[model samples]
Target: MYKIITDGSCDLSTERAQELDVLVVPFYVSTDGINHQKEIVELGIRDFYQFMIDNPKVFPKTSMPSIQDYLDVFGPLAKDGIDIICICITTKFSGSYNSAMNAKNMLTDEFPDVKIEVIDATVNTVLQGMLVEEAVAYKQMGATFEETVAYINKIKISGRIFFTIGGMDYLVHGGRVGKLSGIAAGALGIKPLILLKEGEIFNNGLTRGRKKSKQKIVEQIINIS
Candidate 1:
């Protein structure tokens, strides 16, 4: 049987991953000098978000999975002769794709017969989740490997994502926003509409409030569709 693999950045919960027969390799999140594996974390999504809010002084830094982490998952699958389709976070956002590719190269000599395809998702969170779901569906429906790859590539270009941040502090800490802009937005209750373009994140525009920001995102999607 073939296997679908993705990293923690895909926004799929562990339970959902299991249900879809997808293997989720974890990424690391560091807060207060403690590294937490996102996949095995005890906190749920809501709690994690809350934790971020409660601990404003501690800005969490996320890191891509290591080469060894990819090897640990791919090695056994290769040994078992299971073909793999690994969809990783965008190269612009993280190094997970590179690590997965390196792992594939390392194992190629040992498992010459194993087929491993690593794809750069060029997106993250729910967007990548959607792509992974489509890939799993196509694989289950017996689409050829080349056909599946082609479908993902087509969808990747067509996909558009728009979102508004809850707090500008996170963006400022991550260097996505200037400190002055973040401070001004926070004081004025302004939320910026952000989007992913060509694997990089960008701020599209600003809304006065969170509700308006969300509405603007919906309208943008409707207009584009």
Candidate 2:
């Protein structure tokens, strides 16, 4: 049998993950630099958002899962001779793909008969989750793993998502934007419409307010459609 694994950035609910028989590895996020919590395991999405709402001055930073994290999940499955397909968030946001690969290598020496394919989704959030869902669907349909991999890779290149942040300070903290640009945008109450292209993030343009930013996102989607 084939096993499907994904990281928490996919944003799949625990219920949905259980329903699909998929395993989710979590990333670490810290509100206070010293203490880290697993993204979905220790901190629920709403709770994380609430923390942001409650503490505007704090900038949350994320760290990718470690090699041990992957081994904790992958080892048991490999021992049972299950082929694994691990989907990770884009390398642009985290190095989870690399960690998974590292784990696969160590597992290989012990379980050389089993196969493991670690994938980079080239996206994050629900967009990344969509690819995971697609992989599950392919597995259910009895498609070869190679076919599923090829399809997701093609979609990754073509997929696009437009998003905007409530504050520019988050972008500056993440080193996604220059501090001066973030300050200038913050001063004018402007939000930058961001999107991923070729596995990299780009600020498409700027909008004056949150409402306008949402409108721009819709317009961009409609234009593309």
lDDT of 1: 0.85
lDDT of each: 0.85, 0.89
Clashing pairs in 1: none
Q: Write model 2 residue lDDT over 8-72, tens digit each, in one string.
A: 99999888899999999999999899999998899987788899999989888889999999999
TM-score of 1: 0.93
User: In candidate 1, what are the lDDT values of residues 92-162, reduced to their tens digit?
Assistant: 98999999999999999999988889998889889999999999899889997778888888888877788
- Models 1 onward score TM values of 0.93, 0.94
Measured by C-alpha RMSD in angstroms, how accurate is candidate 1? 1.7
Candidate 2, run of 10 with poorest lDDT: 149-158
